[model samples]
Target: MKQHIYPLRTKKLKGSIILPYFQGINGDRMVVPFIFWALFPLVLLTGCGGNDQKPEAQQGPPPKVKVAYPLRREVSEWDEFTGRIEAVDSVEVRARVSGYLEKINFVAGQKVKKGDLLFLIDPKPFQAQLNLTQAELERTQTKRELAKNDLARAEGLLKAKAISGEEYDSRNKGYREAVAAVRAAEASVYAARLNLQYCEILAPIDGRVGRELITQGNLVNGGGEATLLTTIVSTDPLYVYVDADERSILRYKRQHGPSLEGVEAQLEVADEEGFPHHGRIDYIAPSADPETGTVKLRGVFANADELLSPGFFARMRIRASEPYNALLLPDRALATDQAQRFVWVLNQEDKAEYRRITPGAHVGNLRVIKEGLTGQDRVVIEGLQKIRPGVKVSPEQITVGGEQ
Candidate 1:
């Protein structure tokens, strides 16, 4: 017995199917597969265009960072240190001759000049000694004149051969003895004058006086080791001694050589709260202190108004070098690790690239960047905590000025 075969066909229109079953009688089995195949593609297309489908992922702008243009400046830079103020010149008033102070010449704590009388001792005794010396000197001169007349007469007698040669020699010796007596009396007069001058005490230098060590009627002696009558200190010009660390000294040497004159210093009274009058570097240590590993430097300032007092604590700032054109950034912009000091730079590709930087001196609150970043680079000042290498970023502009 021969079996019958079924044929299937699909129509593009309406996506329906026509089939022949049992050679002439119609059977739906062949059309069933064709109809389902055409309808399946339509169902898939409707699902693709349906509201139930998800939309595409949305993208926002890249993260932003602030940027500042660096400026080149030529400034007088300085290194600062806490220092102590001292008098440029000072002296202690002392009694040269021992005596009872009968009178005080000036008030205590007053400014005095050279040769000014400071105190007076009892002058009555000195005056009496002077008078006695003068009277004795006159009496010695009268005897010397009389002895010379006797010597002349004795010489004439020797020439006339009227007296013995021995008698004439005796008279010549006596005349010489009288002249020696006159010389002794003149030395006594000099001594008396010196004693009279010692009765008054005078200032040795111009300075402000300190508290009086001895008051009027107080007996002071030269034998006393601590014979301090009073102390005087000069206040017109003052000294400021400052200390600098070894590192700072080395850095300054690299900039200004080993000489300190090329470096200028300014002084600010430590008690005062502001910029101070500028000064010059007066001296620097030849060697470093072993214990503290620092160098001692001193500066001199004109304290004309007495604004800077002796023994006052002050601040000394030394301008060690000239200013440089550099990129200045906030200290927070720098990230440090054991590896190196670096900062995040937002590249044109909107990526945060880590850049290594070599830092320089700190000018005010900003830090100088010696290497690794250009003036045009966008520095990650904010949002640095959130940034990482190769991360996309956006940059926002920031305003920054050079060190004043």
Candidate 2:
């Protein structure tokens, strides 16, 4: 029997020793593959350090949007319109009987009562004509007296048979002709009197007078060409003309019937500070203005205080339809793409969701919500550009001022 043992050999000359036994086992041939396999897991683990470097998840809600609760309010429904103020009765005072203007009796821009003296024409020529007519009437009266005396004498002689019937008849005819001449002369005197009175021009209406067209000593003719002396505009009652769209008027008519008598309107002048006066709808045009598709509506206002004047620019608030409660949104909350309007609404879990809205009339800076939104929903007004769909949001309650 023989005992066999593997011997471990070590040779160290300077610093290290190489064992030739591993070479005998083909160890060097396995060096490159073994190094790769040893470092492979470390490289993969270092490059794929995913959990440690994961990005921080976005916190809580995306943003806080301002919101409000829409409540029903009793507002007097009104429609605004641009209009013009006019006088109920306006007339141009023109010179009818012409002569040298003797005096301008009324001041310009003064309120005058009816029959107030406005202007005076020279009456010297008219006075002379009146005196001539009077003299002619007197002469004709004297002739008629003499003719009547002769007719009486003829009638007495014919009854005594000293004069023929033909003579009495001739005297009667003479007296009749003389009497007719006197009547004609009297009529001439009346005509002369009227001509003299016509020299004075009077205000035909109670109104305010405009600028004077003729000054003193301006030669004017009786029955001359129509010359503008001044303009008179009645101020007790004023008229306003307003235009309304045809569709709106028709809708109102369909709901409220044809008449607008009881409808009250508030009127204000353009430069005035407040609505100084109110009026009622007096007229609505039977047809619409073809070009504008609007109907002309007129209102009458009592202007006894003389606050309103003719040709003034006016603004009117008219009751065009019935009042109803509606959802309202701030104009800034609205977003538009192409022609479609939209807004971002908050969900129950505080997420941004887009809502398409149907917009109605504009109530001042606010817009009337017609459809596509419930009054309870929260609408995003500020920070809208920073939000998108499915983003979480936090709603901050806000108080809306004014109409919106």
Candidate 3:
């Protein structure tokens, strides 16, 4: 057997050659052919490996995100405002007659009805005055009766020529003076009676009474610079006063056709979440205020349970727009780019696309999309940070407001 050697000329193997099947004389040239045949498959595979890697290197796993179609529902837009609760009727209870406050007839901070006795000023002085007026009235009546009898006799005497015309005229004049005096006495008596009645201070309105400003045994001047006894405020129906900007007022009037009579309103307190109390717009100021450039508006709410009270800080919303079909998206799906608002919508290729939208009033966790979106558009609600425009996403379809 003759041994032969040859160098492998393949780029994969560097400067090495191995001849395992050299059993002939002068086989150096045969070594090259033999090595090529043995390594041909490997060369072919190396070239194909580049092609196999191209697909994976050019592709990546899609970003996982949660998405859902925009919600479609009938929605009405509301204009929100900050306001305060006011009482429909409020009265300051005052002493009507001057005297010592002898008694307080009502408990403080309690509900009182109209004509309910609230306080008692000392009635003794008023009663004494009444009695003196009554006595004077009786005396005047007696004198007038006597003067009438004298005038009748003088008239009969004048007819019979038993007295002069001047004497008869004088007698009639005396009677007229007596009659005028009696009328004055009667008026005094009536005034005295009215004063006595005023001694018993009564509630002028049905309402909740405040703390007593003048307690029993305190001297209270009445009928002139009357002393304030307490305050009463009606509680059944409450007024919510709000000031709206001039532009907003005009918009509301335009949308509602210049009549706000039936426009509905809702109210929520500081600790409340949504507007739970319902009401109607009862009044809108005809003119806007020059200083604030806002119009005063008031809404009336039924407060039969007395849960609402005057002076409460409240959030109010007026239903200014009519209900219409609207597309809505979760607030989490919304994105803001500078001053413009936008959202990532899933295109047909399952890729994110930036879409600018006009947002309207917020309803719960959803926002009203006034434009730039349809009900069929899939919006990315979660995993927003993991994807951007034109990025492929693995979307998991979710129902709006459903558990993720």
Candidate 4:
């Protein structure tokens, strides 16, 4: 029997070399033509010179990144806490005397000083009562004078033994009662005058007044529960209340002496960048809260611009350590390596090297580097991920807080 040879298929290789052969059983193996070997070198050259092929990109100078020398400055470390801005003096304006709301003396949301008139209640009723009390007091005084004259006459009669002692004693009792009545009437007159004065509601403290709750022409009840007319909150000087841990409280007290008052504190609102508002702690709690193990502290800040309002979310910082010269880097330059904090620094060869850092309290965007860096180290501030243990980098130098 003849050993049959069959070409399975043909493939066009390179430019024009068509080859057809594939492995088969020993008995069916077929020999390839020598023409394939002769043209293989030419095919290789044609494929290499094809127009569709692209050249490899030349390795550009290592990735460009922003770098900065550690900022060296005299700095004070601070402990940060969050709290709310509050008014030092907050008052719920209420009517003290019950009457018709006759007039509103000041516009809503206006700043009012102590004793500034804010509202007015009808004074007609109070004036009438004052008049009645005055009249009653005059009548009582007249009665006391008449009683005195009667008692004097009775005394003479009693001495002469012209009448019983009972009548003389009765006259004496009447004089004393008249005097008591006058005193009661006078008290009533004084109260009536006070009620009339209350007709003009005045601000008890300097503050910004809120909108009136009960407008003019409304009857305000000042009896059992006074009517809430509006609210007022002191604006110039404000308070920020924060709860500090026992450890922090102790640390602050130890550093600034036992008395924490007058120790400088700084505050910033949620939208602010740094602690721009400056103040001092005015009050410290004598006892710690049993549940939280924290003490409440009150910071007093002058809000002359009235930009800081009560109930605003704020961050408060109190000095924790004295000022000292320290090395600092922008917070963006710091990164974590498993359990340790580290930053990439470019060496003399412009290659990044891992530098482990022991960080201290954060001072705004910059963090205090307690360890692992010198003033000469150029830290990688931007393009952190592109940096490797020893990767070369093209660096652009910038200040710690300068824009990247």
Candidate 5:
């Protein structure tokens, strides 16, 4: 090797070293300097090691979710329906005789018993007519008495030949006519008496009366189209009319042997919470409505306090099954996939698993589970949207309260 040293040129550009090229006469090969080789590796290694490294981040624990076991209870399934209150006996009070209404004897919305006076028609005309008929009846009775004496005399005259046969026959005929006249007058008297009694309109049923439609001094028409004076509806024992679907009625028939008589029922009004009023199925329509496919039903209830009124909208529930043990779950826990309803249940590994369920009636806030659930399975009630299948969860067990 020639011991001749060339002028070295170097640069430190962007943390990398640049070397000047030296041409040798032999040009056997161009080789990089040892300093450049060693420094090139150092540059690469230093470049790779220059990135600021942060401590590896710590992963947090699994997401927390609330879970609960299914509520097992004894429940009586009931089929609910919307209905209306009706009266057992409803009557329209009207005057029977045409006359001026003299007095409205009952206060509007008052309780009245059968035979209680409700209205008073003018009785003067009827009374005068009755008196006239009675006087006429008395006159006919006197004439009958005189004719009877004459007939007796005529019979004696016929036997003794004191009078001719034609005269005796005439006397007998007069006596018969007089008796008929007396009977006719007596019949007139009875009719007049009935008319006089009709002047007072009385309650035909025990019930609460509505507001009087016609006021006092109004002439009430007593003929074919009678006046509607007021209305009365029985209150002690009332009825609830419901139109039940034919399908449900058929299901009930299968359970109760084709007759729904005496089937117990419960009811609640529009503003009520639960079914507090109790009654029984007193009537069921013999046929189903073709248009709506519903059957009519009537439930009779005791209204001792007269709290329930007719025409009130109500919800009625009829027992579908007796009390039996069943599993229940929260309705909010259910997840839907098109037509399917599913839920996320935790397995022994604390991982979420999908489950399909069949739901029955709704008891309070809980849904009766007809199938696809066991009491041992822990179901995710809260944080359902935050989880996926096989994802681990930190479950906090909770207890459900209130009615099942």
Candidate 6:
């Protein structure tokens, strides 16, 4: 058998090669050459199928981001608590003498000074009693003068021996009885005078007065079962009462001094913004309440403008720690992952890296970094969402107070 080799001609179709069947010179079919010709195109196609030279991968420009070094400054931590406004001096004005309420001397809600008249009970009855006592005193005085004259005569008679010793003793006893009567009358007059004075109720303290509880012309029961006439509370230099938990109290003792004498405090009311009133801790309960596990604290503030009032719902913050150097970052730089908090830190290679940090109270617009960061660390402040861990970044340096 003679082996015949067919010359394979390749035609390129687009990017592929194609082969056509060729007839043999003899009437017999040439299977071997046809097979070779069919496979020739495949061989050529396989050889030229893949380019050894691959196009370089297109790299994107590094994401632009704003970053800054952590701020290093002295920071003080504050502990906040719910509190209430209280007056330094509060009084419930009541009538001391029973009579008809003749006048409400002070307007409701008006500021009054000490010794200012607040109410007036009808003085007619008290005045009449005083007059009666005074008249009795005058009569007692006449009797006392007569008794003294009689005692003088009795003493002279005893000295001259003209009257019996028993008679002189009797006359001296009568004079002593008249003197006792006069003393009793004088005491009654004093009491009557005091009752008349009490009819005019005077303010015991300087404060703003509440509405009159007993109006004019109403029968008022005084001294024995005194009727409440009004209430007054000091307007300036108010007191604020707050309850602090055991943990916070202990922390305060550890950070600040044991004594709360000068510990500074700031307060804000429900309708107010940031704490505008400043004060100092003036009192601390000697013992903690077992039921509530808290200690009572009192602060004094100057409310000269009368903006604060007693019984106001207030939010108070006490300085618990002294100012110390701390690392701080903008609040925007912080990120939360499940239960953990982290920030994107720019490494030496200018790549974003994840760093878990412990956060603390906010100081202005920045948050104190309690842990996991240092003053030298540069953290991404803006464009946090645009990058991820280990991604290259073009960090634009910014000042610490730029956004603050």
Best by TM-score: 3
The deviation in Å at residue 156 for candidate 4 is: 2.7
**Per-residue lDDT of 1-404 in model 6, one digit per residue for the tens?**
98876653344466664544444565433334566766989899879977676679999899999999999899988888998999999998888888898888878899999999888888989899999999999999899899889889989988999899999888889888989999999999999999999998999999999998866899988767888888999988999899999999988888666778878999999888678889999899999999999999999999989989999989889987778888888898999999999999999999999999999988867899999998888899999989988999999999887754
lDDT string for model 3 (14-78, tens) is 45744433333444333346667789899998987885553445567899999988888898888
Cα-based lDDT for every prediction:
0.79, 0.80, 0.87, 0.91, 0.88, 0.88
Q: Choose 1 or 3, whichever is better by TM-score.
A: 3
Runs of candidate 3 with Cα error greater than 4 angstroms are 1-61, 257-259
lDDT of 5 by residue, 1-404 (tens): 86855444444457576655554555433546779866988799778987877689997787788899999999988899999998899998877789999999888999999999998899999999999999999999999999999999988988999999999989899999999999999999999999899998899999999999998898998868788899999997989999998778988888876668899899999788778999999888989889999999888998999989999999999988879999888888888989998999999988999999998898867889889999898998888987889999899888654312
Which has the higher lDDT value, candidate number 1 or candidate number 2?
2
TM-score of 5: 0.81
TM-score to true structure, per model = 0.68, 0.71, 0.83, 0.82, 0.81, 0.78
Pairs of residues at least 3 apart in sequence or in different chains that clash in candidate 2: 62-392, 98-220, 98-221, 98-222, 99-220
Best of the two (4, 6) by lDDT: 4
Whole-model alpha-carbon lDDT for candidate 6: 0.88
lDDT of 2 by residue, 197-301 (tens): 988888988999998987888987656576678899999789899999877787667866687765788888867644668888888888888999999988889
Off by over 4 Å in 1: 1-67, 146-184, 223-226, 243-263, 272-275, 283-296, 330-333, 349-352, 380-396, 402-404
lDDT tens digits by residue: candidate 1, 248-333: 88887787678675367777875664447767776789999999999998888877788878998888888766755667887878
Q: Per TM-score, what order, best first?
A: 3, 4, 5, 6, 2, 1
Model 3 alpha-carbon miss at residue 81, Å: 1.0
**Cα-based lDDT at residue 63, candidate 3:** 90
The local lDDT score (0 to 100) that residue 61 gets in candidate 4 is 79
- The root-mean-square deviation over C-alpha atoms between each candidate and the true structure, in angstroms, is 15.7, 12.5, 11.9, 5.9, 9.4, 9.7
Colliding pairs, model 6: none
Write down the TM-score for model 4. 0.82
